[model samples]
Target: MTQIAQQHANMDETLMLEYGKGNDTAFAELYARHKGPMYRYICRQLGSKQHNKAQELFQEVWVRVIDNRNNYTVEAKFTTWLYRIAHNLLIDEHRKNQVRGEHLTLVSDEQDEGILAFHQGKQEGSVHNDFLQQAIKHCVELLMPQQREAFLLRHEAGFDPSQVCEIVGAKPETVKTRLRYAMSQLRDCLQRKVGATEVGGEREI
Candidate 1:
């Protein structure tokens, strides 16, 4: 394994042990490491409609994580377990809200443009990068829930296909298929939007 992976493995064990012992710092460390990815996952799942709700749900997930720390086991990867909790929480939230299907709207006008500009600068150097970014987000929004979830887990969250399978409760082949379709759709949509601009530039999906 790479050094970062080794370190994360070691840290997971240590932090869990410390959390079991009621060490706040360890729990904090775990939260700090995971909060961004968890939040992003939730945001993507909810799309723009549930920004405040997703934040509230994200906090609730952390609370549950802390409350249930004593029951944590190291059999699976720490992230696998963490994401399982997140997945369950999301399901519960969805059930509570009776949320189904995808909604496409610009819910947050807050810094999306700035973030998109920065990301575009790093990826495509075109002047129309913001338009392209918005188009990509819209295209992603157009995906089926499972395809979007699988795509985000694989590409955005940096999970392997196997780990995504574990998190999504799908077979590895199923995860691969979802990812393949997601990418193909994204490529087609983006090509239509940006007119053959290189997708993702340095970041090979």
Candidate 2:
């Protein structure tokens, strides 16, 4: 592993212990380490609409971590346990909201602006990338709820296929299938939005 990864691996246990001992800085470090992945996972789970809810849920997750710090064990990867907490929070939120639609809005105005800027910068000479990213987001939004959850758990959260299976309570092969289908749908959608010609010459992800 690179230096940063090695450092993280070394500090994971120490951070957890420190946080459990009421060390706020340790908790802050833990948040800094996992926030992006957790936020992305929540964003994917809620589609783009849960932006505000995600923030609320994120804080709740941290609060749970703090409240239950003394109960943590090092048997499993801290992230796996952390994600489990997030996953449960999402389920509760979904139930409370009675969300029945497949299109969960994952992006807020702020995130949309950042995504737009990211694509725009990449496609400096053309609008293809911007169009492609928007199209992909739309296509992703249309995914079946389970498929979206599985795919995001695998990609955004960087979970292994087996880990994704565990998180989503599916078989490993099922998670693989979901990711495959999600990617295929996104590729087709991007190709259509940007046109086949543009897609042929587009930069690889």
What is candidate 2's lDDT per residue for 71-106, written digit by digit as tens? 988876677778888888887877766665433544
Candidate that scores best on lDDT: 1
Which ten residues in a row are the worst by lDDT in model 1?
Answer: 102-111
Please provide the root mean square deviation of candidate 2 (C-alpha atoms, Å): 5.9
Q: List the residue pairs that clash in candidate 1.
A: none
Segments in model 2 whose C-alpha atoms lie over 4 Å from true places = 1-7, 99-124, 196-205
| Residue-by-residue lDDT tens digits, candidate 1, 43-110 | 88777667897798788888877887888777888887777777787767766655655343333334
lDDT of 1 at 11: 94
Which residue runs of candidate 1 sit more than 4 Å off their true CA positions?
95-127, 195-205
Error of 2 at 105 (Å): 6.4
Cα-based lDDT at residue 160, candidate 2: 78
